[model samples]
Target: MKEAEGEVPLSGGRITPDVVRVGNTVRRPVTAASEFVTELLGHLERQGFTGAPRHLGLDDSGRDIFSYLPGRVTPRFQTWSHDQVLAAGVLLRSFHEATRGSHLAEGHPVVCHNDPGPNNVVFRDDRPTALIDFDMAAPGHPLEDLGYMAWTWCASSKPQAPPARAQAAQVRILADAYGLNASDRAALIDAMLDRQARNADWWRQHLHAPDPRVASNDQILSRIAWSLREHDHTAAHRSVFEAALR
Candidate 1:
């Protein structure tokens, strides 16, 4: 049992739970669901997946403690190089494979990171190496996870997003890296569209709330709208997207 050496505020999480680093551990306010997260992390560890933080139980303050993984987390909206995108795709596939046979992925549930965006990825040597923040983990279609990855990595919703052709090419790269089958390729765009719609609905529901979690709802709604429009534009040229992947 490693004792706390010191503590410092950890930033960037949207919910912004009381999170801090104590020596080699990260402590965050625990919820009723914390036990599930701890179990998930334990499953990942037993399966030999090294891409997630090791859950270290609770601290004296009753906050959930997780081993601190060392690496840079790419800031939201920051552009990534092609190689970085490829590495992210590979890492996500690895996570899916690791969780496939676990209780999380059995018929019991299809636990997904739910939010595997750049901000949640830890980069080492400029490559994505680990993922953190599994608060949104839940049962879902595996394609949903890939859709979230595509949305973030391809800059699908940004005003400065790449051209339609370029976006298609990047999507193809991601699909290829993840080893998606032809059937999966055909449904990729639709999956991404569904993810965008779901996110928009969540933000809309919270737009008028005064809670700290909803504080950024307006900005989030704007991004959702932008992303939906971009995705719609991409869908209009579905032939190009499908062709690139094929």
Candidate 2:
């Protein structure tokens, strides 16, 4: 594999710079990666959701090209006030609504971008515009997608200190915006924990890759796991996801 010249960083997802001018990049015609991209692009085109990248075919280097959507990307933290949280929740709801029923290939399944990491989300003029980097997207449960997003975007466990009362507002706004029903809330509280445990195994392998910046992936994964297990955040979960929504 030729080394990627300069990787544009996306939070908690992997791709060697997803965007390049349509004519400049090159691609391997018959590879699995190539085929998968083609298929996904086709699917999204048919679905006609405007939030994701518009797929342009291969370029000189045989690499895939996707039109970039520009916006302010939100970093993971629990600092958002109730107002911001509500708006973000509403946006997520709208995205899912617009893109729902996009069935994945049989046996392949569908996973919404698994990394709800705040930076992976792009916000422009104070609202989330587009979601980028599908590296971790795979066959899985989307039921947890909103919960994962809520946890990652609003949890505020980053190295940087999170703002006070952010977590509470985030959870409340998300539940209200998503219109999460009784069943949804039941799953989300636990999904927050279970997802981290699952990711712990996934990150161990991810750390060995050439992206040395994520060398502590295992540690990071484990820490999330510990937090999930030890700290249920259920009180906040119920307060926001349950009471606020009702």
Any residue pairs clashing in model 2, and if so which? 25-61, 26-61, 26-62, 26-63, 27-62, 27-63, 72-123
What's the lDDT for candidate 1? 0.79
Q: What is the C-alpha local distance difference test score of each model? A: 0.79, 0.55
lDDT of 2 by residue, 101-176 (tens): 5555334334456665556666677766666655555545555567677666566444453532446456656776
What are the candidates' C-alpha RMSDs?
3.3, 5.0
- 76-116, model 1: which lDDT tens digit per residue? 65667788889888988888877775677656335788889
* CA lDDT for candidate 2: 0.55
Residue 232 C-alpha lDDT in model 2: 51
Runs of candidate 1 with Cα error greater than 4 angstroms are 1-5, 106-110, 157-159, 210-212
Which pairs clash in the backbone of model 1? none
Q: Which candidate is the best by lDDT?
A: 1
Q: How many backbone clashes does candidate 2 have?
A: 7
